[model samples]
Target: MKNVFTTLLLFSCLISAPSITAADERVKIIPDVVYGHKFGMALTFDVFQPEKPNGAGVLFMVSGGWYSRWTDPQNMLSWFKPLLDEGFTVFCVRHGSSPKFKIPEVVEDVRRSVRFIRLHAKDYGVDPSRLGVWGGSAGGHLSLVLGTTSDKGKPEAKDKVLQESDRVAAVAAYYPPTDLREFVDEKSPYYQRFPALQFDKELADDFSPLLQVTPDDPPTLLIHGDQDKLVPISHSENIMQQFKEKKVPVELLVIENAAHGFRGDDQTRASQAVVKWFQKHLAKQAD
Candidate 1:
């Protein structure tokens, strides 16, 4: 039973797909776009361009359990249809997986992907400054990391992508683990299952979103289920408070009676909320 629960918490985030419909046909997909390379592996993401674009981009962190898995971009069309219909081009980003790489390394790969995307935003017809990111579970954790830990580019860097800004305009995360300090000591109930958390104890607070929030952090939306035992609603609540104290724009949507993942009507509501959050925050960036 413990193993089954762990598996569900790890992979359930990927199962919140809405049914495929004609709306999928309105988007053009560009797949396997490499953003960076490390240790002989390519970091890549897929771009889904709406027929009518709103000039903004939203990167969907393609992660669950810190394991970035590849899926048919076609199968994801329905999942992205909400964002596409709103004229936002979507980037499904995959990062280095865990049980091989640790959490810090996974975070670095995602930050590089953001910089790479910002560097080529014009090529994708997206406004580089008008970007947002989102995900659930481990992906959500990454989104919050991006929101709080984003940095201005190193102008002295020789690599052009490294010289590009990694900041995003907004973030929306679902049931993210905000504070990873509990896992630093391997004390969390999930420590054994999520190998990504098996890292140096000193590094936990450095990557924790709750501890990293600052006044300059981007607008953030956090959605969680009240009954989420895997991540717990407190993760969102605590970070929401930090965002508030820092005077950063933030909102929390608590799904009643839901668990680790949303299903049926809950998924629909969660999907719609994410679309609205991105639209509200990403669409209004000044030129």
Candidate 2:
């Protein structure tokens, strides 16, 4: 029975289709970096860089449920190995999920993860100036947070890492939840409350990416499925509207029949477009 249980756990960790394992890459925790860990909440991320890098990198967040596993960097090497081959360093971020940890706490952790990475860039062979972020759904919301709520160059306590800005150079999101307060309609099924005692709008509009966009933000690419039932196209549509108004350099990719994570040709193309965006934005750097 012991051996059987072990096998099942390993299988669950490995065969989980959407997960990316970080075992083969650099995996470590920047201790006490989390705002709160009373529920075992902590911030950790995996790093994948070329044996010899050219000078660019990205911090990638996985869209796990607000309460489930989203990525394992060890397995992700197979999917994003091509990017490493092309000389880009990849950071697979892992943060505490909900129920135990609230939604806002997780958001703060994502920002800390990016801030930690940028603070330790030299030790990891990463080029801090070229850092970017990517994700979907919940993770998308985080990427936006890191992009918009940049630290004001102030240190939290004596930790040098906390002083680092969480700002990202660019963003590539797929069917992301651009607005959290308005995400659920009567037709949706996910939990939309922070303990049944709060309205989402009171959660802070600055954290909403679509609402945070300014002329100063970096260029971005938004992709969505027109028929998505989980996160409707309207999320991206409204963001597109906001970007247009500010005249920010934003691009949108709408697929007619695809839903959620793209599969088949659409998936391949989405991956390619992400690589291209990183290369274009991150590569334009100074020594």
Candidate 3:
């Protein structure tokens, strides 16, 4: 039986997919480690590697709504074992969800995660420069932030991870809210949406991912359903316009009659598009 979540972004992976297979030998699932434990509380991540890796790249996924700790065993990482099959290292990170931590702090946690991965890429069996990230909703926002604002991080910290820019070579975003202010101000066309109930009106604009992209930002793939009410297709439309203005390579997909998940006719096609995007950029990166 196959059950799918009706969120703006959907991933079809199996919890049992990796356990009973020999192909996943080189893969690793890191349980817990504190990234910025001092000031912003302890942030953590789960890193998954590929066997006999064909390339040096990472596909990082940050969770939605800015939460702390990825609790619950089965419900923890349920359907995300496919990246291993795709031959790219994958990382699922946990940062402050919301209210408990503001958008700024949550985005910082994502930046730290990128630095941490790049700093330890060699030990993790990958190259630091060949990194990419993907996410949905708030995670999508951070993906763009980390991918675009990477140059803002200092490149000379004693910690090699901190020294490395938080940049990613590519990104795949699913029905993400690019601008928080616009999201709060209007209701998306679709009835079902996912926004942290505690959104702050004053700071929303400062944290909008669409508002921060620069000309040098990494190439991006923005996927959303035309019928999505939670995250309007307008957001994707707006981003595509900005991406064009910045001259950054961007691919935006709007599935017809699709809601957040884009499940019925959209899921398979959109997923394939993401694979192609990654193959083009992440797999062909300079070593």
Per residue, candidate 3 scores C-alpha lDDT tens digits across 211-259 of: 8878988899999888886668888899888999999999898788887
TM-score winner: 1
**lDDT (C-alpha) at residue 3 in model 2:** 41
TM-score of 3: 0.80
lDDT of 2 by residue, 1-287 (tens): 34422321231233245544463354332222233243454455667766667667787775444443545445567566656766788777767665566567677677777778788889778778788898766666677767766765566657676688777888888777777654333233344332211224467475577778787777787888787766688888898788888887788888779766566687777777888888888885563
Whichever of 2 and 3 has more lDDT, that candidate is 3
**Worst-scoring 10-residue span by lDDT in model 2:** 4-13
Alpha-carbon deviation at 65 in model 3, angstroms: 2.7
Candidate 2 off by > 4 Å: 1-41, 68-72, 183-189, 192-200
Tell me, by lDDT, which candidate is best.
1
Better of 1 and 2 by lDDT: 1
TM-score of each: 0.95, 0.80, 0.80
Worst 10 residues of 3 by lDDT: 1-10
